[model samples]
Target: MKCLQEQAADGTHLLFLAAVYKLLYLLYTKDAATVDHVLRHRSRRDFERIEQSMQYVKRNYTNPITLKETADELSLTPEYFCRLFKKYTGQTFLTYVNQIRLQYFHSDLLQTDESITYLMNKNGITNYKVFLRSFKEAYGMPPGQLRKKQREVRDAGAISARSASSSGND
Candidate 1:
C-alpha cells in the first residue's frame, strides 16, 4: 500500500503502478498453478495454431497464402491473429511463414543439388532480388554460398577419413 501510494504520488512511478495493475489484473482474472502455468497454457495453444499453420504453409509455400486464410483457419480476426502471433512468436505472420519456407529451402539445399533459381521458383519467390536479400538476412549467407560451403565441408571430411583409413591400413 505504501509503495502504491508513493508510486501514485510521482508521475514517473505511475508507469510502474500501471505495470503492477496489469499484473494484478491478470492474476485476479485467472487461476492455475502459477503464472508459468497460465503462460504455458497460452503458449501451448498458440504454438499448436502456429504448428498447424506451418504445416499448411509447408504444403503450399509455392502458392499464395493470404492472412485472411490463415486467420480463418485459426478462428481469429486477421488483426487480432497478427497481434497475438507477433506477441507470442516475435515475428509477423508473413515473416514466420517465410521462415518456414526458408527452412524448406535449407532442407533442399542440404539434400538436393537444385539451382538457386529453381529454389526461388519452387518456393514461390518470383523476385530474385527480394529472395536473395531475405534469404541472406535470415540465414546469414546467400543460399548459393551456404550450399557451396556445406559441400566443401562434406568433401573435406570424406577426404580426411579416407586418408586416415589408408594410413592405418599401411
Candidate 2:
C-alpha cells in the first residue's frame, strides 16, 4: 500500500506499524459503520472522567448502575455527564453497561452449561428482547443457535479425535 511505503521510508520499525494502520484504514474505508465506530474509540480530551466512568461500569456492571449515581461520583450533573460520556464513548451509559454485561454473558455462555435465562439474570440483563437484538447484532446469531452450533462442533471434534486415536492403534 502507498501508506506503508510512505512509512517504510521513515524506518523499518515504522513499516510494521504502517502495515497495521494501512489494513485498519482499508477496513475503515470499506465500511462506513466501522469508520464511525473507530472514530469514536479515538482518545479525547478530558479522558479522566471518561476513564473513571468506564472503570465504574466495569466494576459495577453486574449491579444496577444509574447515570445519576455515576455523575454524582464525578461531581457533574446528570445532563452534563450524559453528554460528556456520549461524546467520549460513542454510546449511552446504559448501552455501555449492557455491552459489559453482554461480554460476560458471552464468556459464560461458552464456558458453562447454565440456562440462558439464568445467565441473563446473572448479567443484569433484564430486557430479553433488547438483549436478544443486541446479542444478535454483536454475534451474528441468536444465543440458542450459537450454542447449538458450538455443541455440534465440539462433539464432532471429539469424535474425530477418537477415530484418529483408534486408527493409530490399529
Candidate 3:
C-alpha cells in the first residue's frame, strides 16, 4: 500500500507494474489450490459414479445390457460413461459385460455337465465365435477342454481314494 501510494505520488509506472505482478502471483497461487481441491472432489465423485455403473452391470449382465441404458441410469452420456468405465476398469463396456457372463459360465461349467452351447446361451452369450474367443482368452483353453481336464483330475482323485479305501479294508 505504501509503495503504491508513493508510486502514485511520483507517477512512476514501475511500481504499478510491480503491484500488478504481485497481485497476479497471489491470484495464481490461490487459483491453483482451488483448482486442485476441486479436482480431488470431482475425482472422488467420478469414482463413485464408476462404482455405481459396475453394480448396474453386475445386476443386469445376465440379460442384454446396453451402454446407453447404463449411462442413462447414471445421467451420463454413453460416450463419457464408456470412457470413464474403460479408464477405471481397463476394459470396454461390452468386454466387461461379457466378462461377467463368462464368469457365470465358468462357474456353471465346473458345477454341472451342461453342454457348452447351452451354458453359453444361459449365461447370455449369443455369439458363438465371441464366446469361444473370450473363453479361451480368459481361461487359456476352450470350455470343453477345461471341463475335460477337470473331470480327469476328479477321476484320478476318485481312483486314488478308492484304492486307499480298499487297502484299509484289507
Candidate 4:
C-alpha cells in the first residue's frame, strides 16, 4: 500500500498493480515438483533461442521484420522457427509483431497528442488498410477512437485513485 501510495502521486500506480498480479501468480502456482517437471521437459537451448527472438522483436518491431530474418538471426531455419514459435508462444510471427506494435500504439496514444496516422507511420506500420484492420482487431476500435477511449479510461482511473487517497487522509 505504501508503494502504491508513493507511485500514486505520479499517477503511475497502475503499473505497480500489474506487477502485484504477476507476483501473486508466482506465489500461488502448484508445487515445486510440477514446476520442475515442466522445466525438465522443455529444452533450455530452445527456450534461450526463443527468448533471443522475442528480444529481437521487441527491439526491431518498428522496422520491417520477417520470420526468415528472425530465424536466420537465431540460426534456425524458417520452418523450424515457425513451428517452435507457434508451439511455445501460440502466435504467428507477424501476429506477435502486430500485437507489439499495437501495445506501443496504445501507450503512445495515451501519452502523446500525435495523430493516429502519425503514430502508425512513426511505428513503421505503412499500410493504412492493414493497420486499421489489425489495430481494430486487437483493440476492438480504430486507432483514433481507441486513443480517445483510452485517454478517458486513464483519466477516470487517476480521478478514482486521487479520490480514494484523499478520502483515506480524512
Best by lDDT: 3
Give the TM-score of each candidate.
Answer: 0.66, 0.70, 0.87, 0.63
Off by over 4 Å in 3: 1-11
lDDT of each residue in 5-53, candidate 2, tens digit only: 8767879767777899999988878897866766666444347888998
Cα lDDT, all candidates:
0.82, 0.88, 0.91, 0.85
lDDT of 4 by residue, 72-137 (tens): 999999999999898879898788888888788778877899888788876768778887888788
Q: In candidate 1, what residue range of length 10 has the lowest lDDT sum?
A: 27-36
Model 2 pairs in collision:
none
lDDT of 3 by residue, 96-137 (tens): 888889999999999999998888878888888988998998
Q: Per-prediction RMSD in angstroms?
A: 11.1, 18.8, 3.9, 26.0
Which residue pairs collide, candidate 1? none
lDDT by residue (3-43, candidate 1, tens digit) is: 77876777758787789999988887675457769789878
Once fitted onto the true fold, the runs of candidate 4 whose alpha carbons sit more than 4 angstroms away are 1-42, 151-170
TM-score of 1: 0.66
For model 3, the local distance difference test gives 0.91
